[model samples]
Target: MADSFLRPAVSTMRSGIAGALIAVLALAAAPTIASAQTAAPATKPAAKPAPATKPAPAEPAKDAAAPEDPLPWIKICSKDADKKNVCLVAKELRSQEGQLVASVALRDIEGDSKKVLLIAVPPVVLIQPGMRVQIDKGKQLEAKYTICFPNACYAEMEIADQAIAEMKKGKALVVTSLNIQQKPMAFPFLLSTFKKAAEGEGIDPNAGQQNQEQLQQELQKRAEEAAKKLQGGDAAKPADAPATPAPAPAPAEAPKP
Candidate 1:
C-alpha cells in the first residue's frame, strides 16, 4: 500500500514540474516571437538640402583719365655737369613750327622743404590772367604771374602734398591763359613730367659752385676775345686805308713859299 501511495505522489510531482518548465519556456519565447512579428521602425533618410551658392562680385569702376597728347613730348631730368640732380623735370613745349612755346620746370631747392613749380608761357599771355591749371579736369588752380622775361612769362607756385598727389594720379593737366587778343588759349601738359618731378631725386650740393665757375670762365673767354679784337682793329685801322694823305704834305711845302 505504502509503495503505491509513494509512486502516485512521485507521478504528481513530475507532472507539476513539467507544467512549470513549459510556462517558463513560453515566457522566454514570447519576447522572441513579438520581436519577429514587428518589423524594425522604418527610419526615413533625411532629405539633403541644396548648397547655397554665392553671388558674383560686381565689377570695379574704371578710372576716368583723359587722352594723351599727340605731339612730341619729352621726360627729362636736369642735372649739373658733375651728374648731380639739379631739377626734377624740365618739360619744353614747341609749336608745330618747331619754336618753343612754353616750358615747365620743378625744382627742390636746398634748405627749403617746399617743392617749387615754375611754368613758362609765351609773352603773349596776359599777366593778370596768370595761369588756370586743371588736373584731369578736376580742380581749377590759379597761379599768379610772378615775373616776365623777354622770352616768356613765368608763373610760380609751391607744390604742396595735395597737389603732388593729384598730379601723380592725373593723366593730363590743362593750363589756360589769355592770349594777346585777350582770348583764352589752352595748353596740354603731360603728367609724365609731373611723375618724373615727383620722384624723390637727389639734389647736387656743388651745382652752385660749378655754375659760378663756368660763368666766370665764359666771361673771361669773352673778355679776352674782345680785347684781342680791339687790339687787332687798332692795328689794322691805319693800314686798311691810307691816312688822309698825311694832311697834304704839299701844304707844308707851300708854307715855305
Candidate 2:
C-alpha cells in the first residue's frame, strides 16, 4: 500500500462534494423567485367597471302663423293739382294686372298734380303724384325721375324691355321707393314720359287710361250718390231722421257738508 495514492484520492473526493453543494443551493433559490413573480398578478385587484350612460329625451314641436294679405294695386283718380288741395286719399278699387283691393285714408294731398303715387302697405295702398319709383316686369323696367345739376330744366325717364321687365311687365311685384316731383310743371312732363314708355312696352294704353278714368268715374259717382243721399234725393232712410244724440257731460262732485 502506498501513501501517495491515498492523498490524491482524498483531494479528488473533496472537489466532488463542493460541486454538489452549489447545485443544491441553486435549485432552492430558483423556486423562491418563480413563486414571487406568479403571486404578484393575483394580488392585484380587477379594474373597476365603467359607468352606464342614458340617452336624452326628444324636444316638442313649435307653432307657426298663416300667410299675409297682399297690397292693393291702384292709381290716381283725379288729376286736379292746382288749388290748395289736389289729391283725395281713397281706398284702392283694383289692380291693373288683375284683382280687387282695399285701402285706408291717411291725409288729403295738397297742390295740383296729375299722377298720384300710391304706397302699398300690406292691405292698404295709397296713390300720390310727384312720386318717383322703380317698376320691373318679367323683363321690363321703367324709372321716371328728374335731374338738376346747375341749370337743367327738363326731366326724363326710361323704360327698357330686357333689363327690369320682371318688375314693370310682370303680373305682380313691390313698390320699393316713392318720390314726389314736388314741382307742379315737372309732374305733367314726368307723366307724359311715363305714358310714352308704357306704350312702347305694349301695355294697353287704353286699358291704363280706362282704369284711371273708371276709378275717377267711380269716385265721382260715389261722391254724387253720397251728395244726393245727403240732400234727400235717393235714400234708404227718411231725410228727416232724428239727429245723432250728444254725449252727456260729467257731473261735478258736491262739497262735503
Candidate 3:
C-alpha cells in the first residue's frame, strides 16, 4: 500500500514539472516571435515640399532720359514783327551737312487759344540726336509754325564748323525730311538739343518777362527827368564847372533880317 501511494505522488509531481517546463519554453519563444514581427520595417510617408520664396520689387523709371525741345520758331505775321507775313529763324551757328551735332523741330500756335503748337515734321528731315519738348506758341511768333507735333522731326546729324562755313559759301542750309524713330506716328523727336543749344547761342525767350522790370525802372527815371525839366528844375552844377562856350555860327550862315 505504501509503495502504491509513493508511486502515484511521484507521478503527479512529474506531470506538474512537465507542465511548468512547457510554460517556460513558450515564454522564451514569445520574444523571438515578437522580434521577427518587429524586424519588418514600417512604410515611410512621403516628404512634404519646401515653401516658395517671394519675388523682388520692380525698378523705378528714369527722368533725365527725356528728349529736347524744338527750335524756337521765327515770328511771322505780328505787329511786333514789322507786319511781315513770313517769319524766319536765323542760324547763329552754321551747321555742316555731316557735322551732325543736334537737330530741332518747329511748333507754331494756330488760332486764338494759347496751347502747345499743333504741327508735324515730315520724316525727310535728317535731324541729329536730340530731345522733343513742347512750348507755347504765342501770336508773336507767327500765324503758326511749319513743323509741329509730339515728335514730328526725326534723326538729324550735325556737321563740323569748317564744313558749315564751306556750305554757307555755297548758300545752303542742311534741312532734313521728317521721320519716326520707333513708331508709325509723325512726331518730332529731337535729333539734337536745339532748344538747349539755342540758349547757349544767346536766344532769351524770357526776355519779355525780364523787360517788364527793366522798363519800369527806365520809365521812372525818364519821368523824373522830364518832371524836373518841365518844372524848370536845374541840376545843381559844381562850383568848379567850366564856362559854357558860345554856339558856333552855321557852316553856311543865312542873312539875318
Top model by lDDT, which number? 1
Candidate 1 lDDT, 139-234, residue by residue in tens: 788878887655457787777768768887766666678877888766566675466445645334355234323543654565578778999888
Candidate 3 Cα misplacement greater than 4 A, ranges:
1-46, 57-79, 82-188, 191-257
**Candidate 1, position 91, lDDT:** 49
Question: What are the models' TM-scores?
Answer: 0.46, 0.22, 0.19
lDDT of each: 0.53, 0.29, 0.29
Error in Å for residue 93 of model 1: 1.6
RMSD of 3: 52.2
Q: Which of candidates 1 and 3 reaches a greater lDDT?
A: 1
Error of 1 at 88 (Å): 3.4
Best by TM-score: 1
lDDT of 2 by residue, 1-257 (tens): 00010011211112232233233223212112222222233244459845545445534433232112122222222334453533222222222221222121112245322333223221111123222333322332233323222211112234233322333343222222222323221010011122223334222334444554565466556557767777875447766989899998889899999
> Higher lDDT: candidate 1 or 2?
1
Stretches > 4 Å off in candidate 1:
1-86, 200-257
- Greater-TM-score candidate between 1 and 2: 1
- Across 1-257, the per-residue lDDT of candidate 3 in tens digits comes to 00110011211112232233233223222112222222355456458745545545544433343322222222222123444222112221101111112223232223322222222233233334232322211111112223332322223222233432232232122222223443221122222333332223233334422432344355456557767786764666677989899999779877999
